[model samples]
Target: MQINREQLFRASCLSLLVTSLSFGIRAGILNKLGVDFQLDKAQLGSITATAFWGFPLAVVFGGFIVDVIGMKRLLVLAFLFHLAGILLTIFAQGFWTLYISTLLVGLANGTVEAACNPLVTSLYTDNKTTKLNHFHLWFPGGIVIGTLIVLLFNKIGLGWQVQVGVMLIPTLIYGYLFSRLDFPVTERVASGVSTGDMYKAILNPLFIFMFICMFGTAITELFTGQWIDVLLKNVTDNALLILTLDTGVMVIGRGFAKPVLKKISPQALLLISAILGAIGIYLLGTLTGNAVFFAAIIFGMGVCFFWPTMLGFVNTNMPETGALGLNLMGGAGMFAVSIYTMFMGSYYDRVVAEAHGNGAFAGQQILHTTLIIPCVLVVAFIGLNIYMKGRAKKSAAAVQV
Candidate 1:
């Protein structure tokens, strides 16, 4: 079947919205619960970690199902999980209950990545980098939407349950849209490419760099998204404003990156992004004033293109791998974040307990320390960038000769 651009865009948007809602929940909910529900550091970390627990399974399974079953079915399942999870969280009062609901949410979140990444890449076969970035904007955009709702709920003095429940509206809408849609067949089906060839391509150095970029991007972006409110609370009088500023700047940075990627080399873009990320994390950790907020804007400018750009790069450069590549990207990225977030959460828990006895620095500070994951990864990206560019040039020279 011929892919319709509008349908693809709509599907992509819905998929991203699903991802955004699931991933964004922890960020907005964590700080509020501390003040309202009286949750402590470890419990709060568990809340985020619970949702992330699906990452390993999602990355592993999401790709297989997409390759085996199809994108539409996976999406339907994802939204169902999301819908049920949100409903459960809306009513959950106890710790175990919250854990169950968030885990469901994480499952649905992984499903979104599973379905949408392939959908978008399949739709825009040529301009994979530009188009994939377009696809992922909704992830962050959903965070913006989720963040706003969280703030509004706080202003009206609503309960946490209501905030969780409200996500059901979007969940249902996206679910309904996906249900009626037709799915694209696996690229392997379309191209008659064998599975062995796809695996061989994925194992290549370039694809490995693709995985590395996703791993770094997930940790850096999520560390900030999940904990920025808590971080801002520590350093600023107006925590909400700071949180808003951080996300707002990120949104703006994504906007700027769309045009820049169109004009520059992906290698050049990655280099600039790494530098911006290092500076952004440093500022976030060390600076406390309005100045730090501005620094966040700069950081957002750096990292905005990282995720989609990497996906797009892989899709563009490795077209023969088909939907398998997108799934691998999602799987690798989510799996990386899952492992890293858990490690950071455990480490931060121990550090906070030792240094401050649960009172000195909040979970936010410890979480922010997770920024080191990406900081180190960003430096590595520089090396990856050099290797990729050199590889691409060599490939081109070989073709010419």
Candidate 2:
């Protein structure tokens, strides 16, 4: 069977677009769900948590079995889950329905990533990092599209249900595109890497170390994004624009990632990103009104290299771990985001109670505390940068000997 790599890649991007659009749709609809369903803050958070938590369940499971099940079957699952999730959410009557719908969307999202990440690595073996960056730009790209959809809907007096229903368009498009193409064997499989070797590679002390780092990196990016609409609403009328502008910056930065990699090592990029992240978060918390846009740009740039570069570094550095390792990294990140989603919700409610229901104060207070995560990451990345460089030198020296 002949594979049209470009068509497959486009399908993969649209699949991811559906995943990110879910994020945008949920962000835009949180308040609507809260009011229409008569749910409390914690319940809404729990519902949101379902989406986050559902991702890891699919990603970890899908990652483990993707090779055996075949990428095409996994994508078929994504399309079906996506279709069901969108339709169910459109008809959701209460908390349970909304919760289940979000979970389905999340599962679909994870399945898409599970299938596509390995697929891209397989398709572009020579330049995995640069291409991964290209592939991941769709994440922000999709969010931008989703956000616009939300805003456009908001302007026309359409409600959240219709906002969600719009996701079906791209979902169907990708489904059709994928149905027509032939999937290549995963890069790990094609390279003749044994399953045993792939399993062994994940337990490598370095893989474990990076796995821990994945928690910090993923939380820094995903948690902020998940909560952005809530966190900034009180501070800026342009609250949505903060997310829009930041993601727009991310789109531009990721589009040009190839040149960026030529100048900086991934480790160095991670360290720099951590520093920018800390500054960006703090600035967003402290500043108000239009000044928030500046913080948004800095935050966007900070996170630009985070998702792709982390996956690229591990995949390139730890080739033996194969698709399983990539999925684990992705799963770990999503898992962390899920945990924080719950935590942030509880924390917000507590702060509001303590402050006598001051959401603005609660918002700023949480941002202050969240700033610590990225601050700690700054130090962690410095050490990581040093270690990776030294390790590279040792590998070169060993080859010479």
Candidate 3:
């Protein structure tokens, strides 16, 4: 089939936007839900992290389904899950219901990502990394969109439940577009690759490095994206207003990554991203006044490309692995977040408990705790950068021979 690159790209972006919707809801709307349910930090994290929990399962299974059933079917299922979860969440009375709803939401998200990541690569096989970054720009972009929605609703005195339910509009529209569109063939399909070859490729040192990078990248990016609202609310004077500001800065950073990835190698870009993220997260935890805002912009810049860039790398080097590789990386990343979220969730409650409403300092400590994730990200990038550089040299040398 002839591939219309533009149409496929648009579809990929929309898929990413929809998949990221659950994260937006968790990040921007979850805390308010915490108040609604009278829940604690632990429950908040559990319900919020439920969507990501599907990652491990989805990563292993989502790719197989994508390979067997196709992207179109997987995407349709994802949209259904997203729509159902959002509607269920609207009327959820207590912690258990919300938890189950979020888990369903997570399943939809996992399926969407499983379907779309390989679709983007198949669309622009010539420029896998660049296209992948362009594809993933929507995730942060969705956060910006979702943040604006939340801010607009708050300004108008709308209920959080209505704001949550309003996501149904885009959910339906994107699903419709996905239904009409014919998805491109997978890299594995196009190459006519065998499963044994793909699985063996997964064991390659470079492949393993990319896999681990996904885990660290997920932890770094999701940790901030998921918790920043609460982190900002705790430290800043105008809590709700800061979400817009932070997400806005994050959007700008993500949008710029397309150009930035072109100018610098992904490895270099990642290292720079790590340094910026580390500084930004650390400052967010420790600093005050206008400084915190500046730090947030820096941190957003740090993480802006971590996920997309890493995916780009995997797709470039291991195109034959197809949706399985993408999902494996994505699932690994989310699994890292699930682990970190649980820790941070418990840790956040502990810090809040210690302070007992005393003020900004308590918030500062929680914000500081977030630094651990970014710090780990910095190290993760350093390791991945070294491996990528070595691999690049090996590829170039092989070509020379």
Candidate 4:
């Protein structure tokens, strides 16, 4: 089979676009679901958490099997799951039904990442980091698209179900693209790297450290991204607009990562991002009115490159771990969001009840609590940056010898 790398990359971007659209639309409609179903923050949180839970499970499992069964098959399964999930969501009656449908959607989302991350890396070997940043541009780009769709639906006085159903359009388009495409062998298998070596690569201290840091990074980005509407509900009626603006900055930042990488090393970039992210999250907790938008811009820049940069770092620095390694890194991030989503929901419930349904108070309390995640990331990234610099110096010294 002939390979057209550009076609495959575009198809991968489309798949990610669908995934982010579903995610963004779901975030936009959480309040509507609460009103329709008479559910509390915790219950709604459970529904959101199901999506995150399903993501890690499918991603990790798909990572293990993607090489054996191939990327194309996993993507086919993802499309089917997405179709079923969206249909089920449109007709969902209560919590259990919504939970099941969202779980399926989350599985589909994870499958796309599990397959496409490795696929993109394989296609652009010389410029893995920059190309990955380019590919991930769709994540935020899709969020912006989904946000606009929701706003349009609101303007027309349409319901949330219709907004979700609109995702089916892109879902079908990507399925068609994948049907005609071919995938390359995973780098690990192509290099004849043994399964034992892959396992050993994950056990390396540096990889272990980075995997732990991913948990914090994921929580900092996704937990906040997923719940921004709820967290800022009182501050602005246009929370989805704020969400769109936040991701809009991400789209622009990631689009320029290629040139930026030439000036700043990836490790230095991570360190700088962690510091800014910590500050941005803290400012978000304290800000109000129009000032929140400025804080969101800071937060967006902080998280814009975290996910792909981390994945690119692992892929570049620990190539021996291959697809499985990338899968684990991606899975770890989703799993963190899964746990934190529920925690944030429960926190909101408790705080709101204590304040007697004071939306502003509840929102601020949750933001303050979430701040700890990014603060921890600051310390972790500092250590990682120092370790990487020392490693680079040692390698250079060895070459001179």
Q: Estimate each model's TM-score.
A: 0.90, 0.98, 0.93, 0.99
lDDT of candidate model 4 versus the reference: 0.90
Clashing pairs in 2: none
Q: Which ten residues in a row have the lowest lDDT in candidate 2?
A: 236-245
Give the per-residue lDDT of model 4 (tens digit) for 129-191: 888999998999998898888889989999999999999998999999999987899888888
| Model 3: worst 10 consecutive residues (lDDT sum) | 238-247
- Superior candidate under TM-score, 1 versus 2: 2
Which has the higher lDDT value, candidate number 2 or candidate number 3? 2
Candidate 1 has a TM-score of: 0.90
Q: Which stretches of candidate 3 lie over 4 Å from their true place?
A: 357-359, 394-401
Candidate ranking under lDDT, highest first, comes to 4, 2, 3, 1
Runs with alpha carbons beyond 4 Å of true place in candidate 2: none
Q: lDDT by residue for model 2 over 1-401, one digit each (tens)?
A: 89898888888988998998998778877877888999877888899889888888998899899989899999999999999999999999898998999899989989998999999999998899998999899888877777888889999999988888889999999999888899999999999999999999999988998898888888988788768888888888777768888888888988998999999998899999999989999998999888899999999999888999999999999988888999899999998888888888999999999999888898898888889988999998899888988998999999999
Each model's lDDT comes to 0.71, 0.89, 0.76, 0.90
Shift in Å, residue 208, candidate 2: 0.8
Model 1 score (lDDT): 0.71
Candidate 4 stretches with Cα past 4 Å from truth are none
Model 1, 89-193: lDDT tens digits are 787776777788888888888778777777776666666677777677777777777777777887899866776776777788888877776777765567777
lDDT of 3 by residue, 220-332 (tens): 67777677777667567655445446556666766666677668887788788778877877777777777777776776777777888888877776776677888888888
Q: For each candidate, how many residue pairs have backbone atoms clashing (under 3 Å)?
A: 0, 0, 1, 0
